[model samples]
Target: MKNWIINQSLDHPGRTVLISLILTFILGSGLRFFKVEDDMMKLLPQNMESRKTWDKVKEEFGNTEMIFIAFGKSGESIYEQTTLTSLWDFTAALEAIPDVEEVISMASMNRMDSEDGFLEINELLPNRELNVIQLEEIKTYLDNHPNVKNRVIGQHGDFLNVIVHPIDGAPNDILAGKLLDEADIYLGAYETHFGGAPYLTGVISELIRNDVMMLVRAGMVVMVLILLLNLRSVPAVGMVLSVIFLSLFAMTGSMGWIRGLTGSDKFLFTLMNTSMPIILLTIANSDGVHVLAKFFKKFRQTGDKREAVQKTMDALMLPIFLTSLTTAIAFLSLIFAPIEVMTGYGVSIAIGITWAWILSSLMLPSLIMMKSWNISSRALTSTSILERFANTIGKVVLQAPRKVLMSGLTIVVVGLAGIFWLNVEVNIQSFFKKGTKIRESLEF
Candidate 1:
């Protein structure tokens, strides 16, 4: 069956291209469903004790993430009429946001004071701007009530806090941006700072977005450079890059389709998704190098491109299959992790690596077969840098076999020892480089 497929590809390369294109189109269309999520709880196993407690709390509280805003005026009391009015208006604006369930600030907070020996509950600050006497009275009341004052007003009565409670299932990332934008409107008159889970989620989501774009583009550039310098054949580089691209596209689209079909609320592989393209690129390019090297070596012996491809495919079939299978199995081992996030990571990466192997076997060979033999002929005659490096390594290994074996053993032992000292820490701020907006915002 494998030989027959290779013969078909060699005989009718156009048909192979057409079929690959159709599959690519179908899979690529699913990319639109891909989304980035930053929620940490979703990545934990459903039955994990911490996750269970979080779910129960969320159930009772209807989304426990709060957007906390600190409002303060430099060298002045926040209870001043102008600052109070701005705070009131900002609170109203926040309440008007679609996902916002409640906005608690001095505008909506209740004040309890004794009136004629009976208790009177009223808005902390009246609706209208307060005169000097009223402002003094409010400050005096705040000083007397330590519990309310400490929680709602800052230590010196210079800052007021506005807490925003989002509706259940509200997208915190989107809501964070809305809250920041609304706060910006009132920030001209006061120094406003934002914190809480929603803001942090939004910041981390942005960092992930930036990291994915930068890393994927950079990885491709590095791969192209290495392939061109080592292979010294444009067609070979093109074929390898195309295989990598298609493999990534298929993996991403497949993930999106799965998420959409299952109606999964949480994106289980947020970090894994960001890193998948680079991983696929490395795997796809490694396979491509092997295939192309074998094809060139065979072509040098036979001087016939078609015969060379057939021989290369026949020679590599079992080897590539076993190599890819072992790697895929290694990745699949992650599925056994106690955390669901790692399971998602393992499954997605394993599938992606498998897709890369399949594409390298089929699409890459098809592309090489379709290209002109003139470009590939020179590849066979020339001494590529990679070949020279391999030859040099082989010579060194032969010359000092015992020394090389001892060195390798020492390195492996050191690596094993280092594993005992490894530590795992999740510092969200470390996700972004220093001086970045997200990192600065988090620190501030």
Candidate 2:
């Protein structure tokens, strides 16, 4: 197998490159179909008891998710006439939104009392404009009805919360946007915050999309810079980047293909899977770097590009294949994970690693054969700073093997001990930084 690959790459380098590009393009075309999965419930185990109960609840109650819009003023009461007017207006606007089943706020609530020994129920805010006495009456009613007050008002009477319930299967993202727009129009002077599962779902979806684009681009840029510094050749860096890009394209595109073929969203990208591209970038780059470094060293010795390519493949092929295989197997272990999203993450990443190996073995070698490298005697004889640094570390390890072993063991021991202190952050809010709008809204 190795001889066949080497021969094809050397004898018909163009054909080999053409085949690789054709395969990459065909597989990568599916990228347009890729979609993001932001529903956190999908990440949970389908058969879990809690999950089953949640599903049952949703089945009976129909989208129990609510979007809470809280209005407040710093160091002031929400019972003022102007604040009450704005709150009433905001409640009406929210109720007008499509898919909104109910809107609960101080303005929307009913006032219950006894008039002429008969029970009476009337609008909590009968008019948008309230007099001073009417404002005090509302305040007195809230103070008496603690349960109702807790639902619509803040703990300290500083904020009024409007809870909105949307119909089942409603698009929360669109609805949240409309709700926020109305809040801006009606309660622009007051401090406003949003919460509840529906609002969070919408915000997290946008964040996931942003993160996928930003992190992948950033990772690619950083990898290119590092490759340039280490390889010190534009062609060499390009070859490595080609493998990385092709691997990522194949990985993401395969997801779309899987979903299209099976009609299942199980393989869709999720927050947990966001790191897959970065992982592939690092691993794919490693394989290409190994091939290029070995080829360069061999070419310096033999001064024959063809012989260097053949010998480089012969020496490193088995080792690189085994490394990628073992890494993929390690990730494949996640197939047994309870959560469906994690299982998908494992399978997708495993496929990515396999593709990376294939490209590094075939495409990279073919590219090396096609390109002409200019290697001066000075360049051949002189070692790079990275090589020197590696050599220095090798010498230290060889000179005091026992001391090095002890230091490594001690570090591992400390890491093991530190596990006890490590906290598992399951809060979705923790995904955002402290001052981020989403985090602040959730905290509020």
Candidate 3:
């Protein structure tokens, strides 16, 4: 198999390159149809009872997701003329947005007054103003109605809240954007803050988007720096980075294809893109580095790129294959985690790892065969700090085998003893770095 792949790729580098490009283009086109799902419940498995029940409820009642907006003023009662006017206008503006099923606020609340033979429903502040007597009466009534008081009407009438319930299939980000845009127009007189499921989803989705771009770029920069420092060859670094880049493209594009064909949920798209690239890059580069080192060693000895790559493949295929398999299995274990998001993450990441392995195996070798890729032989011969440290350990192990063995046993025992101190706690908020808006909002 090794000899066949080498011959096939080396014998027709142009054809190999053309085929690879065509396949990549076909797979990558799937990205045009990719959808991003921001709902946390969508991450749960479809067969889960909780998910089924939630879906049923949503279908029956529409999306009961509320967008809560709070209004506050400094050193003034919410019943004051300015605050009440702003609140009334804000409530009216929010009610006009499409898909907003209902808006509940102090301005919109119904006050029920029971008479001798009938009941009357009237707006709590019908005129948005009150005389002293009317204020006392309304306050008394609000104090008796615990459900409405303090929730929409503040205890001291110094704050108010508007709850907008959206209809089913409402676009969360667009709705949130509209609400904020309207708030900027209508609630400029008061201090305003937004809280609710829709707002949280919007905020989280934005954070994930920003994190994907930042984290992937940062990971690539760090990977490149490390590769350059260790390999000390521009061609070597380029070959490794190319494999990583192609692997990421293939993994993401294949996910798009899967989603397009099956109409799968987009739960894994952003989350996986945010995390899997860094992990796949590292894993892809590890195998590439090992293969490159072997190839370089052979080439330094014999000065033949094709022969060196072939010999390296023959020597390292089994070991690299086993290493990738075991690493993939370790990631696949997340499928058993209780959370549905973990299961999605596990499947997506495992697929990415497999893709990375395939790309590295085929493309990396093919890339090497396309050129001479000569490098200074002194790279391997130099005694860097790492080499000196490794030599010292070898000397100690050889000269004092019994002592080294005892020390190793002691270290293992100590490590095992410390294992009991480990604790299992999953704080999802901690996943976001401090000083981020999402983390701050969650903490708040």
Candidate 4:
């Protein structure tokens, strides 16, 4: 089979390249027809008891988790009478924000003023003339109470968060940073202390976004460094990156197609976050690297660029095929997971591994055959590592064939037995990392 690939590539490398490209454009484009759902909840199994309970609870109360906000002045600014007066004026303006159900402030509380005495509680005010002394007295009261001194204002995001409940729950989203921005502008504008739901939401939100961005960027940087360490040439690295992007493009396009077909919600984006991409890259690129490395090795061996591709394809084809099959089967096994999101992730990546396998095998060889691949001298310096590893594996398998088989079988049986005996408990809460706002929000 390896000899056949070598011979065929030596004869018509261009044919290989052209046919693969056509396939990529044709069937790859057909993925445009698939429809998938993105709603985060849809990813969870409908059969679960907790999910059922969660859905039931959300239906009645309309959602009490308000978008919180808080603000603090820089100096003794709130101590001044002018600042206190401005806060009263700004509180009146905040009441006009759209969709506000209610606004509570010290000044807005109803005043039962009498000539001899006064009492107060928050209710609609009765129209009456107030003397300057009376308004000043209210200002003094607000200055002393830290609740008002720590102003609570609802801004746009809180308004949105308050409004956009899923009739169940939203995808864990960042409202804290957005709340902080609004609090900063509103509090700074009014020259008053502000503290409430929005401020709290913003602090929690920024922490989440920072962690997500950090994890993703860190993964990319690490992968790039690995590639550079393996193969120093920019073009080689670029080719590898191209394959990665190509797989991603195909996956995203297929996801979009699924969305169109299913009329699914938007939270699917949350499910794909990072783990799925890593798995996709690991499986797909592992095959690609095997084929590419062998191709280069053979090319150096035969001193014929065209023959090198065929030789590489011949040598790497079996391992590549086996790895793809095993990876696909492993992913397909995840259909057994009771979680819907896990099911979606498994299905998406399983399909992606297949596409990556096909494209990487057919297109990469063709691309290499079509163009001259000149590598830098430094990174490829250690084929001995791959070679020695392969050699060691070969020797061990050859030396203890029966022992290896018995050992492997014994281990598998023991592992299976242990797994059967183990008791496990799991839930959606496990998916979120510790110290996350989503958990905090859920608890609240």
Q: Pick the candidate with the highest lDDT.
A: 2
Write down the lDDT of every candidate, Cα atoms only. 0.78, 0.85, 0.73, 0.55
Question: Which parts of model 2 are misplaced by more than 4 Å?
Answer: 117-120, 377-381, 425-429
What C-alpha lDDT, on a 0 to 100 scale, does residue 388 get in candidate 3?
A: 57
lDDT by residue (tens digit), candidate 1, 1-444: 888878766887778777877887687676677777778666667888888898888788777778788878756777678888888788889989999998887788888988999999987787667888988878888788888788677777788888888888888778888888887887766677777887777656766787778988999898889888887888788888887888778777766766677766433447545787678778878888889888888888898888999999888877888888998899779867776666656666677778778777777788888877773455778768878899999999999999999999999999999998988868877766797655665675
How many backbone clashes does every candidate have? Answer: 0, 0, 0, 28
Could you give candidate 4's per-residue lDDT for residues 1-444 as a string of tens digits? 556655545567678667655655554463555433323445557878886876777576654444432222434333344444444544455555443444454335553334446554543221233445654565455445545434432221111011211112322233333333444554665322222333333343444345545765777688778766565556666666667657755665555555566755431444333466666776666776676667667765676777677667766777777787788888878767776555556666777787787666666776777666554354344464545677898899999999989999999998988876775656544545665645544443
* Top model number, TM-score: 2
Candidate 3 lDDT tens digits, 1-444:
766766665677667766766776676677776565567676667789988998899888878788888768755776566677788788889888886888988778889989897999988887755666766676778888888787796555666878899877888877888888998998877767677878777666766777778888898898888767666678888888776777667666766776778675642564544676677778888878877767767777777777777788888877888888888889779868765556545665666677666666677777778866545545444433544576798999999999989998999999999989997867767767897655654564
Candidate number with the higher lDDT (2 or 4) = 2
Candidate 4 regions with alpha-carbon error over 4 angstroms: 1-44, 47-64, 72-178, 188-216, 265-267, 271-273, 373-444
lDDT of 4 at 330: 89
Task: Provide the TM-score for each candidate, comma-separated.
Answer: 0.88, 0.91, 0.82, 0.64
Off by over 4 Å in 1: 32-35, 71-82, 127-134, 156-158, 188-192, 263-267, 300-302, 375-381, 426-444
* Model 1, position 247: C-alpha lDDT score: 78
In terms of lDDT, model 1 sits at: 0.78
Q: Which has the better TM-score: candidate 2, or candidate 3?
A: 2
